[model samples]
Target: MNREFIEKLENNPVIAAVKDDKGLEKALKTECEIIFILYGDICNISDIVERIKSAGKVAMVHMDLIAGLGSGKDVAVDYIKNTVKADGIITTKGSLIERANQLGMYTVLRYFVIDSMALVNIEKQDRHGIAQPDVIEILPGIVQPKIIKKINSISKVPVIAGGLISDREDVMNALNNGVLAVSSTNEAVWEL
Candidate 1:
């Protein structure tokens, strides 16, 4: 991860995760320093990213959620780097995380921790050092303080609490528990 970018995240712990054009517009007008785009296609992803940049904020695309990008990691990474010019990318695939790191783009490896097995897998992945993403995003962050603490204890990478963060308290709870930041699609929460 870029140290400067990470610092920005630290200073502003609330990240706007937008899923549509309306969300993007609201995000652009908010106090958010980072925007995680969960919706877009090949035809408009670049435009959206550019718009975010023009507003002096960072834009991160969720590679897996983007339509028309297919499943090829290399192609998507290349496009995101060269065309979209996004500040970074968020993905659930370890391979893509590695590839994005190689391309010098910031990466957030998202993990949906629903059980002990998932927690064990995250530990194993961190230990093996196969795909060390710049940041690890734990989903359903609204109710996983223990899980978040566990991941933080074992991993050297910064953790981002994402998904289901609906209010200021949710954002504060994640940050108070040791996450570097919180990613939320809730426009109202972005101000926090």
Candidate 2:
């Protein structure tokens, strides 16, 4: 799964983050090769997955905020693979990221540099393949450039930029930072 998607991502570096069915069509039309549904309600997710497949792009579901999964990382991983039938998983928990790899599912780990504490934590770790997620989705606070650079510096896997990235410049900044891609629910990015 990772091998196949890596080849695709090597060629096209952006993923259209779609929140609903309406955006799926636009994402497909705009040639966004990958998609991630940010929510994890199973009934809703099943429908979204169908839409993603119909649009002919890979569909991934975020498990961190998924409803009903306990705080335990293992439970979250199990819920996504067994109950959700997601093509892949997105999460912040390193344990879940490792488990997803073991399950042979594409995993994207979402990390943030928002608070001073988070920044401090980031500095302490050599993030290279720590959780071993197939992709690392970095939250670009106010400074999109810094986020891009951070992704390029430590991540061995592909980097995907998310959060506070609203326009073409942000997307371009992320790509310029050696990011394999950027994901946004904003329909505007799709048009770009």
Candidate 3:
């Protein structure tokens, strides 16, 4: 649905997924244009998003991981958009993705590929307005190339690799398999 964000990741696939203050500090100094704020409570979430925004990087906060926020309602999405001022959100929940999309925020649907059902889930990602994912991030960046190829074939949206991405080889493997980008906590891989 969002071709612009897709293009941004395509140009610079290296993304910094920050889970702590140290990671955020380091992420600001890197070449990553997009930063995933995977940690933060309600108390400090705004400041965290502010810092990333001030640094001019797209800030995508993982809602499920953020503490002090209720996940059962659309208020959380409203808070993230209006209060936190994040560029977008990364979530596994379809409802949240729908809410975020309605708010005009950038949205990434994160999927953990554990089996064939997971692949089937990707194929089932349809347009119900809220069901749209600007891009889909598949976990375990080290999956088989055919699996990655299968994902690309089924998904109309761009795909990215995440989780357990340790080295350049893992990044290369995913990219070679046709993933548009790779997100990693490893700083060394960010330099790739």
Q: Give the TM-score of candidate 3.
A: 0.95
lDDT of 2: 0.70
Which segments of candidate 1 are over 4 A away from where they belong?
none
The best candidate in terms of lDDT: 3
Q: Write the per-residue lDDT of candidate 1 for residues 98-180, one digit (tens) a residue.
A: 88888888889998888888788788889899878888889888756787788899877898888889987888889999999
**Local accuracy by lDDT, each model:** 0.88, 0.70, 0.89
**Displacement of the residue 189 alpha carbon in candidate 3, Å:** 0.7
User: In model 2, which residue pairs have backbone atoms overlapping below 3 Å?
Assistant: none
Better of 2 and 3 by lDDT: 3
lDDT assessment of candidate 1: 0.88
What is the overall TM-score of model 1 with all chains considered together? 0.96
Candidate 2's error at 15, in angstroms? Answer: 1.2
| Rank order (by TM-score, best first) | 1, 3, 2
Q: Is candidate 1 or candidate 3 better by lDDT?
A: 3
Best by TM-score: 1
